[model samples]
Target: MKIKLALIVILFGLLTTQAQDKITVAVGTNSTFIETYNKNSWSGNFTLNKAYRLGPTSLKTLKDGVKTSLKWIELNNSYYKTFQKEVCRFKTMEKESFKFHGYVDEFAEEMTMIFYGESDGSFKIEIKPYNSYSIFITFTNLDMLRGFKDLLDGKSANNEIDDIFKK
Candidate 1:
């Protein structure tokens, strides 16, 4: 009986750790990206910059309006944050009245999402592809910023997109 109880406890602990290890990507929020960008483009108020990081081995070029931007970073071994994800997180930090900061996200693929918080409560988007390359956009626009904020608040705006993230 003692051995059986010990085994059960060990199994439960393993299960919990496994659950935490699985990275959750809010892919369903893809529509929020489209809706917000469709209404307006990124504002010139923000400047784009790339932060040096490691992880992915390749990056993919995608359209951000008329300009070509790095859309996805090939996670030679991991995934990076999408452009919008970075914006929302940065905004959160600013809302908290904190300076711009960065936290390591190893779960991200080669290309990671980056946020640069500003003194006035704005951030720049850096789509760092896998390896050392990155695609810089002008900056997130008003609607895009709002959508991103909504995303961080747990409001996916569009249900169809949000459902995609559901297991």
Candidate 2:
């Protein structure tokens, strides 16, 4: 009976382990800043210029059978240049003064990038006005994307990475 019980326990353990379908990574944060990915649903479209600045919001106006794309933001090089441009010459500029913690995969462009800032416990996005926008993403979505990447890369299976997935 003990042998049967042990076998059953082992089988259950394997089943449970197999059932874990998620891959994850750890973005360290100090005690002050709770991981925002744990909360909130982020939705919005964004663009990142070569410099990494957040672009301005845009609008459209049509009249007399004519239409125009109104660009509210202009790309700059002097203030926003850290974020590299993948294509078009127009670049974006911004700073990561330890305000965010997460990552994203621009699969459309075939690349993955991470964003992190010091964990000061304050959720202040230190963004400037009318800067070029690059890679718009919310914390949860970005984390999920990273998780998928980790799964495919076998990062989840490695015991060394297990520590990063802790809640």
TM-score of each: 0.24, 0.17
For candidate 1, write residues 1-167 as lDDT tens digits: 01111000000011221111111112211110111111112552322122222111111112221121222222211343333343111111111111123323332333344544443444344443434453422333344434433443344556765565453
lDDT of 1 at 142: 40
lDDT by residue for model 2 (58-110), tens: 10001100110001001221233233221112212221322242122221122
Best by TM-score: 1
Q: Please list all clashing residue pairs in model 1, or write none if there are none.
A: 28-161, 55-110, 56-110, 78-109, 79-108, 79-109, 80-109, 81-113
- Model 1 earns a TM-score of 0.24
Name the 10 consecutive residues with the lowest summed lDDT in model 2.
Answer: 4-13
Model 2's lDDT to the true fold? Answer: 0.21
Summed backbone clashes in each candidate are: 8, 22
Question: What lDDT is obtained when candidate 1 is compared to the true structure?
Answer: 0.27
